[model samples]
Target: MTREEREQLLARYTTGELTPLERERLFTEAMNDQELFEHLFEDDALEEALSDPAVRRHIMNTAPAPAPAWPLRWRWPVLAGLAASLVLAVILIQRQLTPSSDRSDEHTSELPSPCLLLSPL
Candidate 1:
């Protein structure tokens, strides 16, 4: 075949457009012709196939699923709740530590205990 015809056949093979017979013929010829083998080797067919969206989708579907993001979506809220709880705990601790001097003994002595109030008569 002329150089142009040879190049056209290579191009068809690159695009995966060749019949099984054509593919067999090309491979058989390539096995004997170092120059033709070099031409096919240099072609960017594998790159083109990998870049195709269908190939990418197939790879994605077959690959293991990535770790779930269920915790990530709740991370902010959980952190916020933890922070709020920490602050509330700190405030309660401070309240318990600092004794209030506002009307302690005098006011407490006037009120009856809840246990006596709630007891059966």
Candidate 2:
């Protein structure tokens, strides 16, 4: 099916407006298109959530407050610092997870005894 036709069918399906044949055709297409199926599943979930008054109330109650405005100079410095820190963290994590011969030996080796060193001395 064409992308436009699939989208129109999906819209109708989401709105509970699809005829049985259209619904069946959409389902058949969904079987072939994983991304489309996931989108339709999310839309169905959203529709169900909106239909429930309790879920709507909870979402509204728990919504985060908007961020306060900051000066451009302050914002740029803070954002740059955060981005640098994030990059550093990712690099460190990657290094730790990737096995290098030297790093693996350091991690696995036990410390030598102080007494053994003193005796040699």
Candidate 3:
């Protein structure tokens, strides 16, 4: 790959955003190119302060850590499903509680229409 492409791949690889194949290509290119290997740390303090004990110790300590394992991968999905079900249930209950026109007959017995009340008056 060209220098620009390699740089992009290197960035992605460093950030853990590269695909497996892209990571393979990046490592292969870095191995083949001594200058590129040096260039990877060209701007970082690792190149200038690498000889210092403190710097070396910090580098060893601060190396990128592994990804943390999740306890349950389906936890988020389960919660989302539960939230959706709750919302749906709330909507259904609200619709049921709000009297519909179809049930007007039942309401008319207790709360007569104004026209019906006025007819007697």
Candidate 4:
């Protein structure tokens, strides 16, 4: 491969996106070419920032301070209450539409259901 092609392949190899055959070619080229090996080494250094906690903390601390833990802890319970309310609403609607005869004391609607309009002749 030409110098530019070798550089592009080396960048892909550093990103771990190169196939095995491409990686082999990159390794072979790096061994024969000192400048390509230096380029790969520099790319490796750039990726080292991810695994370094000090750098990570410095980057994260630049943003606003995070919220307190209490709100985060209550988020699940709030979501569960909303879900339970939805389920209760659905059950109440279903009961109103088709109430059991055992509860005759409750005020029930006397209107003919719109459902009968969809019946086949």
Error of 2 at 109 (Å): 99
RMSD for each of the candidates: 14.5, 20.7, 14.7, 13.8
Clashes of each: 0, 0, 0, 0
Cα-based TM-score, every candidate: 0.34, 0.52, 0.32, 0.41
Model 4, residue pairs in steric clash: none
**Better lDDT candidate (1, 2):** 2
Where in model 4 is the C-alpha error above 4 Å?
58-121
Model 3 shows how many backbone clashes?
Answer: 0
What is the per-residue lDDT of model 1 for residues 13-112, given as tens digits with 9 covering 90 to 100? 9888999988888888888889898777767666778789999889789999789867688989999999999999999999888877765777888898
Model 1 residue pairs with clashes = none
Q: Best candidate, TM-score-wise?
A: 2
Residue 35, model 4: lDDT of 88
Which runs in model 3 stand beyond 4 Å of their true positions?
39-121
Candidate 3 clash pair list:
none
Ten-residue segment with the worst summed lDDT in candidate 3? 112-121
Q: How close is candidate 1 to the true structure, as a TM-score?
A: 0.34
Ranking 2 against 4 by lDDT, winner: 2
In candidate 2 the C-alpha lDDT for residue 6 amounts to 99
**Model 4 clashes, total count:** 0
Query: Model 2, which residues run further than 4 Å from truth?
Result: 67-121
- Residues 1-121 of candidate 2 have per-residue lDDT tens digits of 9999999998888778999999999989999999999998989899899889999999999999877777667988898999999999999999988989997688668766456435644
